[model samples]
Target: MGVIYLVRHGQAPMHAYSTDPVPADAPGLTDLGVEQARRTGLELARQVPAFTAAVSGGLARQVATCAGVLAAFGEVHDGPLPEHVVDPGWDEYLIPALPGGPTPDMYRSPAAYQQVLDAALLRWTAGAADSDETYAEYQERTSAAVDRAVELAGSGQTVLAVSSAGTITALIARLWGVPAQAWPTLARAMVNASYTKLLVGRRGITVVSMNEHAHLSAADVGLATFR
Candidate 1:
């Protein structure tokens, strides 16, 4: 048996002209985003002992968040715990065909953009969208990555993985057996840098907690942006 901690990346830069056509792999974290990661890392260090290992999506934000958290742990332990492993399978689902890319002027309001993104996410998760990564493909990749992390944890070891809201939501939906159409509810409620804990045993993975953010104060509780 092992425990797996799935953490969503810290806030990202959200601005009118923020959307750049960079490869999904290289989007950088914003200043506030870095602060969010640092706060999350500090909190986790105070709560958890040494984990077996840590993993993260290769995205810059994910990697930065993982590093921030690890650095916090080092502040106490004063030593590196373990090297981080990068797995693209754990990356967020990308909807290249979405009506418009991430930009300020595309949608009249944040609510409208969210609605459009949500619909696209639902369609992507339900295998109704055509993209480089389908919903089914995402499921297989993320699930496999989690299973592998569990295997690596073995016993008496915790595995921490930093991912995105979409990936985390998809995993939760799979765990709760929720349909793709209901993902909007999950996405809407997911918080940046929030965490979900899972315990994996012979039977399977059991969710111990979802979207835990006790470490964050009320002021920290809100949508975080870098730009």
Candidate 2:
């Protein structure tokens, strides 16, 4: 038996949808986002003192989150941490190509932006993807990543896998037998720095927990973000 923890990266400095050109690659974490990751690490270390290894997507947010979690682990536990692996396959699904996308800083209501995103997500998951990376491709790569993580846990070792909300929810949705139409909802609701724990053994990928974010308290004004 082994455990694989999936962590959604902290809130990015800028969101791809909100930012113009949306940045071709990874973006750094904001100050508050960094605190969120640190809290996650501290809380997580309390839950699992010893992790066999840590892994993350190649994105900057994911990489930073992995480091935060490990650093917090070291703070709570007195031992050397395991190696960290970077896998690009675990990255989030690309946004669909829009014929006339909104300009950067166009400034619109959140509702309007969500409307566009919802429509795009529906098409993407339906195989009518408007971009180079289809929803199916996203699922395929994420599933492969999780499968490899489980196989490589090396007999009961615990592993931490940090990635974007889309990738984390896609894997959990598969394990929980969720339909495609409702999958994006899960991703949208996930808080930055939250995690889902999966137990791997004969049963194979059982969900011990999902969307755990107790580290972010209600008193904190701007901590529980789902961007």
Candidate 3:
């Protein structure tokens, strides 16, 4: 058996919604986000010392987080960081745009955006999403990515995969047989730069931990944001 670690990318710049058409998949990490990734890497290096390899999702934020964490690990540990690659299969489920391109200012509160996101998910699950992929498609992609990660890990090797909140949570939900309705709620709780661990055995993957961020101290509270 081997271990697979799924990491949520650090906080991104431009988290607030903008009326202007944001470039798809363009956002990367903020300064604080970079530090978060670095801290996470140092923590992981302390915990797991060695990994077979690492992989990252296609998004800039995900790849940047992967690089930051691995770089920090290399600096703290004796060996150079292993080469990592990008796989779009671990990309987050893209929520369809609302009928009107509404900005955060359009909503009464940030929580209201969750309603919009849920509505978008309803459409996605129904195969009526505006984006190229439906929710079902997202499940398929993320599941495949995880299977590939397990294969990459091989016998007793620990491998890491950096991805978005949706991808990480979806994989956990699917692995643990959590109900579909519970997915979004679980995803919402995933802290940025946090990680979930699983033991990949001949039978299948088994969860060791989920959405852990113990490296972030009380003083790092500002870096412990969800958005």
- The models' CA-based lDDT, in order, is 0.73, 0.78, 0.79
Best by the TM-score measure: 2
lDDT of 3 by residue, 1-227 (tens): 89988889998775424435666665578888898899889889888878788999887789999999998888888875678889999877654343322355534464876777766665555566566676677788888888889899888898989999878888878877887777778888888899898888888888999988877645645567676
Candidate 1 lDDT over residue span 30-87, tens digit each: 6666777777777777777777799999777788888877887777765558888898
Whole-model lDDT for model 2 versus the true structure?
A: 0.78
From the highest lDDT down, the ranking of the candidates is 3, 2, 1
Ranking by TM-score: 2, 3, 1
Candidate whose lDDT is highest:
3
Question: What C-alpha lDDT, on a 0 to 100 scale, does residue 100 get in candidate 1?
Answer: 34
- Model 1 ranges off by over 4 Å: 15-27, 98-108, 219-227
Residues 36-138 of candidate 2 have per-residue lDDT tens digits of 8888888888888699888999877888888888888888899899888898878776543532333334324555555666666776677774577667777
| TM-score comparison, 2 vs 3, better candidate | 2
Of candidates 3 and 2, the better by lDDT? 3
Pairs in clash, predicted candidate 1: 12-226, 13-226, 13-227
